[model samples]
Target: MHWKEYIKRMPLEVKQITGPLVLGEGPHWDDRVQALYFVSIHEKTIHKYNPASGEHTKTTLDGRPGFIVPVEGALDQFLVGLEREFVVLQWDGAEGSAVKFVRKIGEVDQDATKNRINDGKADPRGRIFGGTMGDEKSPGDFAQEQGSLYRVDGNITRVADKIGISNGLAWDLSAKAMYYIDSLEQNVRRYDYDVDTGDISNMRHIFNFPKNGLDGFPDGGTIDTDGNLWIAVFNNGVVIQVSPEGKLLRQIPIPAKQVTSCTFGGPNLDILFVTTSHYMNKPGEGDPQDGCTFMVTGLGVKGHPNVNFKF
Candidate 1:
């Protein structure tokens, strides 16, 4: 498809949410439930958005929730990364249903409060991999070498020590490589990912942004069915579509200052759902546009199905 045609096909209406959202990220679309699962880390909230009925429901958490994903083997289970610990949590947010403890962090800090888990996803092999951001004051602080990427499976954990601001992660099917972002460094790194062992190697930088005119940092992202990487740029309020080889294919400009994450959804995968934030910067003349949810037509990027809980 021609790139010009793609822009012409932008969706008619971008959905707006009622929010003064703080630190929004990690959007997952559940096709079976016809809902979008997203996190507002600062609010310590998980929200469910149903398009068909225009119904939105939010559930609060005790700990600042970072990334949330379903179990790969169990249909009814889910995992949540809270500030201080990882937990097997019931989707309902019940008081006694959160199974957690301050186990040694498989790869990094022991105190969750010292670091915040950012973007994460399950590999085809069913392991969850993500990293954390250290406690910092920048609206979305991406600095701190203490932030390390992690892999969690069963009782064992693996940590990659050279990481900083571990955010945005996904994989390619044929090559089985892992694509990850170091949001703080303004770079995206690729790895020779070992799915079965949850190990990564040949780690090297592939791309970095915030070039001459860009304002945002890199945030969360997704891999399209075609293996392209769609990354949200933090301060810039834009999403960039890139080829697996680290080439920029195109860009989608958004009104929000923080384009925290992006996911492809809807029946045909032509819809792109972006989660934004209301946490940073002085409101521009059009600041309200920055935090609203955006949907654009003709993305042509179909996302992989969310990993389900294995029972």
Candidate 2:
């Protein structure tokens, strides 16, 4: 609402498929395959949909594909989240899929009400980083700030010492800056990221949403071509476009109540692909559009290509 460069948008194309996904979120566009990849947390599946042809494929993975990053030279290799563990999946087209356990989570008992894998992304240098929440079975763990952010190299994974639901994660073009959101705290943070070493430090809050009668939190988000942050507003039925400096640009309204994550795709990256939820919708105040996929066209916005899994 503060930046003149941004504008409101309508959901150009809204599609509600049969998968009554528990919590539909995390959207990644695969340029090579000309498809969009996303996941539903409660259902524990990865969905592949070709935007051009509307062809959809469902892959029930071992753990939830909290997020996805392609393999550099291999059409099969993909880095994804499997519950609290991080796995490298090899998609063999018609041959089905193969998975390698890259990082194994410890036996930390999370509050069934509070612990789940939340959001993530790969650094330009190819290391994997993701946020965690109390799994669907353990939500109490996060309400108490038990879940934290994590990082993994080849074999070792480091748990961030302190933080609440590590929700949003994205990388800038240079890979030198990383954008993040601390959901419970209601703020977006930035850090000096080292692509070569996969080290993140110098944390600072760049954006903090106003408690302006909004019902939800700023969940998952991505950095745009102009370095602005496009964040999905959970429970608010909208997405907020914020400048790198944390100034509100525009509020793109949708018909859903629980908007989870968003990403920029399309040939020129002008389209914004968004995912949503209906889990916590109150009765009588519901919008049927919840749990559906909405497309935002003519955003004139472009996003950075997701970093591929180097291993």
Candidate 3:
């Protein structure tokens, strides 16, 4: 079937859940707790939403949170990318619960004060693959190639360096291939992954934005059960679905621009939860739904369970 025809048959329903954030990023669904978790980077806050009860709560953090992932065997504990350091966060998800910084597991870019962690995800085996980006005070203006990608398990290992804007990560169901995005490059790269050792090699570009006629930089992404990638495009107001072979399968238009990240959530894991940013936009300039977290449903697909850090 033609890509457009296939997409036309798929019914889509999008709804805004949480909103008006300052740079909302990183949406992770905790199946164990049946809740959705995400962070607003510039706001330095972590948010949790319970769909069953329609309850939304946020906890302010001391530093910018690039991403958050649940820790294995501990529901209240999470590993967060806090500025330049990877810290263990303890929060009970209670209303106005006090948050605690348990300890710092690892730190990156010690000499580069301007760099901070960006997007991250855990491999099927529970090892974290996180990356950082250089000082980016404004859109399209950042220190190029000052960031690096690191694999965190027992130790921190720099798997790749010279990154422009580290964003989006996903491992295939078989754990044999990894998909990554560096927004500045406007492309998605595939890597041969080793699940046992947390190593990646043989990197190759799988998707190019301009070549495919896509408008904005590719931001955060997640993989469906079919191994297709759903990527949020910054400044494009769309989430695109790309086949494993790098074919443009579908373009899911969002109501707001500055779409940052997305993840599969909900009881059946068929819902795609997306996050957007309000960075640099004046109050009356952009869409009212800007910086809101949205839920895209009825795609007729499901995603794997959220991976947790082994630590």
Best by TM-score: 3
Report residue 298 deviation for candidate 2 (angstroms).
Answer: 0.8
Model 3 CA deviation exceeding 4 Å by range: 1-10
Local error of candidate 1 at 245, Å? 1.2
lDDT string, candidate 2, 56-175, tens digits? 666667766577666677775666776766666766533134444544433222444335567777666766678676533432223546677877566546546455667778887554
Instruction: Write down the TM-score for model 2.
Output: 0.83
lDDT of 3 by residue, 33-62 (tens): 999988999889988999889898988988
Each candidate structure's TM-score, on Cα atoms with residue i matched to residue i, is 0.85, 0.83, 0.95
Worst 10 residues of 1 by lDDT: 93-102
lDDT winner between candidates 1 and 2: 1
Q: For residues 1-311, what per-residue lDDT tens digits would candidate 1 score against the true structure? A: 86446645665445565354777777777766666777788888777677677666767778787877765544334566777455666564332244433233343466444777776777777677767777776664545676777777765364676566778888886886888887777888888877667678898887767443456677888888888898998778788988877788878887787788888776555567888887776555438666667666656556777664232
Please give the range of 10 consecutive residues that has the lowest summed lDDT in model 2.
2-11
Sort every candidate by TM-score, greatest first.
3, 1, 2
Superposed Cα deviation of residue 60, candidate 2 (Å): 1.7
- Write the number of the candidate with greater lDDT, choosing between 2 and 3: 3
- Candidate 1: Cα lDDT at 150: 71
